[model samples]
Target: MLPINRAVSRGLFAGLALKAGSSTDVAWARACYAIRFQSTSTHLTDASNRIRRRRKKPAFLDRTPFPPSPEEAVNNILYNTPNATPAPVTRHVLNCLVSNEPGVLSHVSGILAGRGFNIESLVVAKTEVPDLSRMTIVLNGQNVVIEQAKKQLEDMVPVWAVLDYTHGRIVERELLLAKVSTVPHEHLSEFVEHEIEGQEVEEPESRTSFSPLLGTALQRQAITELARLFGARVVDVSLDGVILELSAKPDRVDAFLKLLKPYGIVEAARSGAMAMPRSPVDGVFEDEASLEVEDDSGKVDATMLPPG
Candidate 1:
């Protein structure tokens, strides 16, 4: 039997010849058919070579062994890859004391947003002073940019003070509440009560014997112990889960959550970071050198300005 390609070519050329109306056209079709068959083997050879080239291993791969060393394998995988190191940006915490009025939060957030500054966490609430509110904002940015942002915040109409507490000695804390699952593993089987001759028989406790209720109790105990270790309180408990509350520094809170993950955390919520300067002297601003008003008589009244 003729090859499929050759058979199709012969049929195609025969059709062309039959369709030719003139003798010259028929002769031209015959010559074209001869040329096509003559070049078929060369074209097939070139296509086969192309396929083999594509199937061959890349030049870099050929230099490495079948099972490359760990380091070399990693290098090969990451060859010509871009550096994955992140930009140098540090978290900055700013505490702004602003007027307690409507649109204050919106105005403050808008200023940050307009400048392309992302507020990672913002906690705003009424301050000790009745007319003032404190906004604790956490964001990541370069030091210079954060400093400029602080200046802008201080210049706002409603803002009374802007404190950059990122580098200062301050007490920072975050609150976390997590619900952890208390369900026991399915593999634990409860003790089975059997009957023999109408008499109730209980299976004796053994290595294989495990009660789901007991397992659940043990799991709760473990959770309680972990909470105690992390200084977390068991706020609420249910048949299926228990809620834990923790107030600690951000890192400590993260560590506690990491340890609680084994107990199957169902849900979690965090109150963003709240911070205050550790020293009373830190927040106080220096008094201006000149507070006296200049008058035609050059009379100075020290009482005009309040005592610093």
Candidate 2:
């Protein structure tokens, strides 16, 4: 068996305690668990201080809580709440093609971080050609906010293409590293609430595009009509505030954005795009598709097993 991290082992034991059996040594087990928990914290802190001491610089150490195993997490939910079902979290992956240039990564990260979205994982590698890099960013946000982020990215000068990879067709992979911070229970509720609300607001976001009008008189009239008509908040203003962004249905967004094209506009940004499959083949069709793994038989066959 692989060595279990302290957090995982401790969490498992904590879960097991809630399912105590009469034959078990409850008092002794509880006492042992408490001691182990304190010792682990102390060791971790001491190790951190030692490293800082050697370096002679103050450094903040980040510690990550171990993710619960799927079974353990399910057990925790069922045991803690006998009546409620734990809803599965929806996750999405996005593939981005961008000009391989300086500041592109920073530009992308800025857009996501500014919107309070958490990027779960990211992988960047050069594609088959020079000066082109492919990026895979895994993120968790409400469907709305993520879509908005994607649209905003597409509008960015450096981005060539952005594809959502959650659906089946493309090969998708990401690398993740995390640091944990403990927040008080009261603060946690507020933080989580803010996250939820932000997601809800971003979901219905849509954009409109318009063609430039033939004459200046008609273009000015169109802009005025749109500004007077739309009730959604203005997220962006382009073409000297003639082109506007308003949260609305897909049709409304299209009508509003399209009305601006006749005003001698060179470019416009409609930042409400979300990643979904152009077709159903974007994700796995059945269980068989997921069970397939890499062709690793040759690699494994060449290695000798250690003596038991």
What lDDT score is found at residue 178 in candidate 2?
14
lDDT of 1 at 203: 37
**lDDT tens per residue, model 2, 20-124:** 653556675565466566667877999999988898665887687889999999999889976756444467688899999999999999999999877766667
lDDT of 1 by residue, 78-193 (tens): 99688887657999999999999999899889888877888878999997889999999999888777888788888889999998898887899999999997756552222122
Maximum-lDDT candidate:
1
The candidate scoring highest on TM-score is 1
Off by over 4 Å in 2: 1-89, 173-308
Q: Determine which window of 10 residues in candidate 2 has minimal summed lDDT.
A: 173-182
Misplaced by over 4 Å in model 1 are 1-87, 185-207, 280-308
lDDT of each: 0.79, 0.59
